[model samples]
Target: MSHVFPRHTRQAPPVAVAGDGCYLIDASGKRYLDGSGGAAVSCLGHSDSAIIEAIKTQVDSLAFAHTGFFTSEPAEKLADLLVANAPDGLDRVYLVSGGSEATEAAIKLARQYWVEKGRPEKGRLIARKQSYHGNTIGALSAGGNEWRRAQFGPLLLDVSHIAPCYEYRERAETETAEEYGLRAAQALEDEILRLGPDTVMAFMAEPVVGATAGALTPAPGYFKRIREICDKYDVLLILDEVMCGMGRTGSLFACEQDGIAPDIACIAKGLGAGYQPIGAMLCTAEIYAAIEAGSGFFQHGHTYIGHPTAAAAGHAVVSAILERGLVPRVREQGDKLAARLTERFGQHPHVGDLRGRGLFRGIELVADRDTKAPFDPARGVAGKIKKAAFEAGLICYPMSGTIDGKTGDHVLLAPPFIIEDAQIDELVDKLDTAIAAAV
Candidate 1:
């Protein structure tokens, strides 16, 4: 029996002893290729000398200073770097220790912004079905996953959930992809109108729906329409990219690919590349000004809001990603990865779809490919696939409940930005074997 409480009480997982590039070696010396970057977190791979050195260097100088007292160089430099390349009008960074904390801060900040602007009634949050933001109570309340929220239902605050932009499942057979995109995007407007628009505070979603729905990407013009609705209603748009941002989706910010920017965005996972714990909530200049001019302060603070060593790791990671041109490489290799996956599984009897953007991709598995019918959840297909993948020495992010949080299964692949062509082949090969065995 282990004293450290593992995530799943019934099963104690393999002990990860070391990580070399995209592979993690367990205590037993089994090497598993990190095909999903540990749930799309590690973009620069597990071992990067520069990032490691940056963390050590910052720690040697300064580790932590209370945000209320002093500001650190690494934090200042990171904020500057992020704002310089952030989506349009986003001028400030509110750093946090992890994804859940970042989201909690974003939700509270959105409320505070409205309060400062004298729109205190705007407190309702709108999210989408099959979407995930984080696990904190606030973020959990904002999420739409039934399985996650069912037990905590009594504790979770009321929030609205609309249809997700899931083309393969939600799109009507006769509708064109673009029309389906438009129709899906229209849900927000309908929901807002039903709720009497002004009562709503923020509309939050993942640019590429991660974790909960197996890397579901929005259809063309979907986010464009979403932007229009949010603009018309004056509802703050919060893109929760904790699992999909920071160049995992080919661009520095996934919103860049969608061609629309959010009023506020939460980013983590790849920002520190696993070298340190760091997440950030970045916001538009107008939003920042609302609070700055009203109360002269944003009424939120965490002890580790801006730790120096973690900030140094984040700054170095972001700087290296842009300076070394890893973003373009992610895009290019992502195309090749998609092509290879399609070639391998596009026609498989159990494979229904291969979709996603950049290095982030998903392979939805089905019992019947023609109808795109999901395997019964009782079968536990996703869990079986994961076990098989691990047995085969491959680490892929596979999740069930791809549809309505219960029935569907998908395998998500988010390899490191530094992944090579040969590594892609190895990834696919292992996945192919795993899927075959699992089925």
Candidate 2:
């Protein structure tokens, strides 16, 4: 038996031997189309010569440099590029290894900002229920996924979880989409008041809920209201785009489409495009200035905080994203993908909703179409669909507990921006087959 620790101990996974474009080849020579980009990380696909060469050149020249002693060229360049393209007021980048680190840094940075501003009592954090930030203890504490947090309650910090802006399930029949968005956003205001706004340091949420809720896009005007609320209460707004940013949502930042910017944002996943492990937490100049003027330090870091090779990969990946005109291409191709999904599963008996923007789309499943009832959690609809899709040589992301962390199921599709029209059809066809087989 293999000694390696696996995510699922009962199953032995295939050894991936090679990656070509959007497909992965196993040791047995079986090819599986990467329909979900391996949890939406591979935006440029597997065989990008530019990124690979950048990584090689960086390592050959200078790979390891402690951030405390010296700043590397690639890290500086990557930070500049990210800040240049980031939302307004987000001018600083705290580089980390992956999504969890980015989020952990963001949380700590928020707390530090409050302390530096001479309001140490503003230490409380607020996150939305059914949202996912990351898996590290601090990140997990900030995330509101009940299932992921159940076993670790003793170690978690006291963070408040308000209702997520999941309009499909939470919006009332009498409300228009815009009205529902404002109403949903009102939960943040309610939580702030309940916690005493003066005690709250920051409010964290995924601009588009990923992982736990499967690309649950916020209702129209939801984030705008959220921004206003944050500003009104002196609470910093933090948007976690680990799974939906870096052109995954057809824009460099998913919040761009919502016409708002956060005081702090955490991004990874697609930043290095699976070429290297890298994530970054960006904050407004005001937050940075607080630390600069007060403590002259943030008082937190990791050993590999600014790995040069990873920075080089992120720089090259981002350069390609912007220079190759992939952003607009993502919009064009995303429309095609959405149309194909609609054509294939819009009216299926088990498919209840098709939602999302850009290449990030989600298909929610239901048992009773009219009533919008979920399948029994014990049935494992999502798990069976994932297995069926993988066996059919198509890789997709399906998860249960989409609604309230226990009831709903959804398949998240986030193909690479380079996906072609023909490949879109192939993805949908394979998913249809898998859904039919599993459901």
Candidate 3:
């Protein structure tokens, strides 16, 4: 019997022994294709010698350095590399241990920026429904997924929740995609007004919604209008790219495709490529300058915020992504994967919508395709699909509560950027088998 606390107490999971490219080997030598990159973290596959060597080199010299006293070379270089490739106006990086820490920092930074600017009343945040930022108190409060916050209601901050820009289910038949996007974006403006724009500090959202909503892509013009609204209201825009950024969406930053930059952004997952646990929160020059000029300190940090070894791993992973031209490869392979999914499940009675961009994709399962009705929660469709896929030597992300946090299901695919054509075919074939067995 093992003393380790697992995610689910009722079931015993297979012991993963090793990773090779896009596949994970279990103790029994079962090779399971890493179809979801272990929650979209491993973009360079599992056996990248370059990243491993970088970690080894850094640990040989200095493994860790507390940020309260000094900063390491790897940390400085990693921050510079991230800001150099980040969206416009984002000039500084606040390194953290993982996605939750990054988002938590973004929230605190937004609040502090307002206080420094003499707007102490601007402490409230506004985020869209069905979104997942992170699991920390601040980040969880900013996320609008009801199921995640149900038990922690009293501890959550009072954040205004607005409707998501989900074109598939919310868009009317009369409106065009662009029109629907604008109408959806209007929710932010409406919420700001209702909450008194002066009281709102920032609006946070994922560039491409992940986890809670799968790879839900924004409609055309959605984020551009959102940027305009934020500017008009003096509210900061914070884009959470924890799961979709770092060349996973055919761009270094997922917001690049939307043609707009945020005042602050959070990134993780692929930042360390599974070699190390690292994340960063980036802010505009103006925001950084505000804190620098006021208290000279942001007033928030963790012991492992700038672990030197993790920084070295992140630097190497990012360098590999850019130097090897994986961003363009994501686009090229993403198109092929999308085409294969369409060809296989386009007309399937149970598959409702196929959507996403780059290598991130989602397949919403529905009982009635014509009506877009979801399967009953009691049926456990998503859980069954996940089990079937894993049993069939595949690892995919299938989650329930995709629609409103309790009523829908979706299978999210985010294969490593190095996945080949043969692996793509294998993924689709195994997914087909899983869906057929589950639904």
Candidate 4:
């Protein structure tokens, strides 16, 4: 009987005692390969010496510093590095404790930016129905994961959910990938016109849809059309990269591959590489200038916003990512992983789709390959796969409701950047065995 609340009420998880390389060790000395990098948070693997040393040194010197009173060295340096490497026009960073907080701040910041710029009526937000931003009240409101938002519907703010750029299921047989992408992006324009562009503040989306939709990459030219629409309508573009950013998709920012920049972008997960709880909401110079010129404050604060220890950890993690040339390594290893997955699961009857970019991959299961129909929801395929995988000593993210909130199943794979070629085989083998046992 444990007093601490857990995500699953019926079953308790093993007590993880240590992590070495990409494997986590339980108290019983069992090792589980981190196939999904613990929800894609540990990009540097579990035992990163540089990050550990940085955290220790920072805590030994100065552990905490409230953002209200003073700024810390690590925070400043980290912000500078992030801004330097961030998408074009994004010039500022607002540190937060996690992904949810970063998204909440982004939503509020967008609203505030419109208000300060004499467009207070522009309060409506538009997101994709298959996307997920975060879990906080504001963040949840922006997210379109129906299952997660089902219970909190009454409390959520009004947000418009347009069609996601999911080429796998949504694209038509007659249209080319580029044609489907443009057609999908047209949904945003249609929604913006329906809501009256002046009444719309921001359009939020993930460059690569993770978690809910299982690493759903957009079709070619999708984001370019999205960017054009946002520009034409004067609506801010907010890209939520909480799960797919920070080198998870090979590049430091997932949007880089998309070849577009957002007015605001939220990033976390791999930023601290599981060494610290940290996330940041980055904004364009234009948006930052609006707040600076009007209110002189963004109207957001958290006690731990600029915690020195966390900043130190982030700085070290990012430094390692850049200096150690891990981003290129992510691309190289990601290709190998994809090739291996394709070779293994391409012909598997249950595996319908194998898609994604870099290291963030998704395997969608289907009941009928020809029809691409999902297994019945009652079957609990996702849940069963998760259990079997864990029991088989492999940690992967398996979630239900890939098509919508109620149906479809997919397994998301986001291994660490440090994973070796041999480890990739191990990951795929364990997952193969797990799927066999589960199905």
Local accuracy by lDDT, each model = 0.93, 0.93, 0.95, 0.94
Error of 1 at 126 (Å): 0.8
In terms of lDDT, which candidate is strongest?
3
In the range 78-172, model 1's lDDT, one tens digit per residue, is 99999999999899999999999999999999999999999989999999989998898999998998988899999998999998999988888
lDDT of 2 by residue, 1-439 (tens): 7999999998999999899998999999999889899999999999999999999999999999999899999999999999999999999999999999999999999999999999999999999999898999999999888888999999999999999998888888999999999998999999999999899999999998888888899999999999999999999999999999999888999999999999999999999999999999999999999999999988899999889999999999999999999999989999999999998888999988999889999999999878899999999999999999999999999999999778989999998889988889889989998988888
Q: Give lDDT for model 4.
A: 0.94
- Model 2 has an lDDT value of 0.93
| Residue 188, model 2, lDDT | 92
What is residue 369's positional error in candidate 2, in angstroms?
1.0
| Candidate 1 TM-score, true structure as reference | 0.99
lDDT of 3 by residue, 1-439 (tens): 9999999999999999999999999999999999999999989999999999999999999999899999999999999999999988999999999999999999999999999999999988999899998899999998988889999999999898998989889999999999999999999999999999889999999999988888999989999999999999999999999999999989999999999999999999999999999999999999999999999999899999999999999999999999999999999999999999999999999998999999999999999999999999999999999999999999999999988989999999999999999999999999999999999
On lDDT, the stronger of 3 and 4 is 3
How high a TM-score does candidate 3 get?
Answer: 0.99
TM-score of each: 0.99, 0.99, 0.99, 0.99
Error of 3 at 380 (Å): 0.2
Give the Cα error of residue 319 in candidate 4, in Å. Answer: 0.6
RMSD per model, one decimal: 0.9, 0.7, 0.6, 0.7
Q: Worst ten-residue run, lDDT, model 2?
A: 207-216
Alpha-carbon error at 298 in model 4, in Å?
1.5
